[model samples]
Target chain A: MDSCQPDEKLDLAGVPCPQNSARTLIKLEGMDSGAMLEVIIDDGEPVKNVPPSVEEEGHRVVEKVRTGDRWKILIRRREE
Target chain B: MGIYLDNAATTRVDPAVASEVERVRRSAEGNASSIHQHGVNAAKHIEKARNIIAGSINAEAEEIVFTSGGTESNNTVLKGVVSLSSNEKKHIVISAIEHPSIIETARWLEEAGISVTYVSVDRDGFVSASDVEKALTAETVLVSIMHANNETGTIEPIKDIGRACTERGVLFHADACQSYTKIPLDVKEQNVDFITLNAHKIHGPKGVGALYVRKGVKIAPLLHGGEQEATLRSGTYNTEGIAGFGKAVEIAHTDDVKKMTELRDWFSKELSENIEGVLLNGPDTQRLSNIINLRIRSVDGNRLAAELDRRAISVGRGSSCSSSKSTPSHVLLALGMDSKEAEESIRISLNKWTRKKELGIVVKNMIEIVTELRMV
Candidate 1:
């Protein structure tokens, strides 16, 4: 699949870390299997932590886009 | 968390007080206004808490009127005085360095047809009694000054100012939210008619504070509802928070933060000796031991505060509650600091339990961060 549409999108640029990651995980958990969630996070710690943490929780990162100061990532929830 | 030195903004609740709050929450389930046994039991705890809080401030238990917190307590006095004053006596006298609660309330009152006189503090942040007296006029009905400033930690000369108000037949109110349990407050000896108190600043639960009104002083109620708190503040009692507040007050005075003073002096000395462009904001000897405000030349305060946060060390650049306004502190400006210096100022307040080892991290981080930022 190329440029697959996201099922949900969350903009968490100014939100702090750990909490932002937790909120992302919470959003993913409520989604159906194989659904894609798009997230926009701050450039530094949130970018470093959220994607890997999502993968650690068994999700797959399909896309990552960086534009200077912000990061946008597309994650597909793992099918059970 | 690396190091926490923001106690002036808010303190981490002591473990004992936290447990006490949980205990009251788990066991007490009665309204103090109800007529049942549970209600009576709950009321006893509230009164017991009241007695504990009043004892620390040298006020009678009956003199205490529980409000939401310091803001409400200050608002109650400022607004209540204006509403209750006669048309001919509608003037309010306050210091320039007061917290937003009193200052903003006074501003609102001015728009509502009351006169407000803002007395400026000295460069050292002390509002002298003579300045207050000069500000007083024939129509002045109330004078509200803080016991200690939140940003600069400067203690006001309330005893002299209180005397001036007393002699002039003006009711004096002190927002003692920053100094309530930390200092010896004898309302009678100080000639004060009203004083504000809060628990969270001293390691108690938040959302609970009280106003101490001299027995016969009449002020209109801000809330008009059920007959609670002697009809001065009417709301469902915050039983658990009050209980923890009582315990916090007990712990605050009995186990004094005397060591905090020594540790704070050591921290201040270390910072000034090690950091090149450091300037202490308030007087060296006349400020609160737990709070230290410093101005670092050539570094933005917000950047420094964020750098500290990235290193897991929490500190405050201004009044934590209203710093979102993103303006230089009015308190710092009142102390004669320019907007540039005021914007560059940061406040680090330590708690009673703060240790030297933790302070080591603060000093090392300050040297690194300030140096790195200046190079950039």
Candidate 2:
């Protein structure tokens, strides 16, 4: 497991794609530069779509790990 | 402020309506559901508003259930019917050009084992009654068709479709949010069992709308609480908003409709004469008087809308309600427009406040912009 602790956490499990990605972006927008945000999202479309969408906004996806039906994704806010 | 031509999405609330809202707020400060004098005062305001709204569509006061807005009213109808109907009655029929509220709700219902048939529209965005009739089945519980489309302003044959649905023993619901007060609507004459009406589109405050359920028509409630709105919709009444909605409806005149129709025609003629390759998106005569949707060849509608915005002339690329999406308009696509063609369309909806000079300015600017953009 990664030793780095996240500064923020958002549990978006069961939230559908596009909206989950949108919420994740909105949350990242409120964070400071280089702040780490841990987001819990549903497995299938969320896992497949969220990280790429986050990356497209110039943010970094630190890691992703499966936890039962949900996946926990670590995203670092883009530096301004 | 810039010239606003996106009235189909929402209009600037009339000053009179705003004053009525303010008056209602200052006069009463109690929940409309309570039995106290303050509550009774608030309830009276709601009842007065309900009566006005119901009378406009030829429905009774008790048949009107106030809701948050058109989206909620449509949702209440679609979901409410499914929840109350028997398992055998699992199917619904709707036109392909329905608002996103209806289309999306139908999609959600599909996930829960409800079947939906989206009847096709013609190239002019016209949904024929026969098409809707053909889509209905023995298990069809409801047939939903909008009175006039928000995107294209193509008026559907709601009366004919309503008659067909009634003959088939299926309930007919019409989303009249775009057509309310702008056109004639007689629920009894049309055989419409349910109608969705909203205030924002008619120069009233936002966040207030109504669903007209014909007397004796039973459906489950979407919300459960103090049983406000005859137990069909529950929550504290938006007394001020409802009063403003009534004022808006009361002030809407047939003369304004005639004025809008004449202005709309003149604007269309000017654009067609000056702008090369511009095509009207819907039927020329059988559409809402206020809406003018045009397809400009060799121009990106989104870019055109943004360009117009910079010039202080606001217009909508497809439905303003769904403008955030990069995808082309689903309504235009349903009307047989290709994806690129749909993307090339922009909607210009006028209001009672819109002046001829403003439309003339828009027309001139559009001609120059389309010409310049085509060169690129």
Best candidate per lDDT, number?
A: 2
Our model 1 lands, by Cα RMSD against the true structure, at: 21.7
Candidates' lDDT values, in order?
A: 0.86, 0.89
Error of 1 at B286 (Å): 1.5
Q: Which pairs in model 1 have colliding backbones?
A: none
lDDT of 1 by residue, B108-160 (tens): 98898888999998887899999999998999999999999898889888999
Q: Kindly report the docking quality category of candidate 2.
A: incorrect
User: Candidate 1 at residue A58, lDDT?
Assistant: 89
lDDT (10s digit) by residue, model 2, range B314-358: 898899877999999999999898999999999999999889999
Which stretches of model 1 miss by more than 4 angstroms? Answer: A1-80
* DockQ, structure candidate 1: 0.01
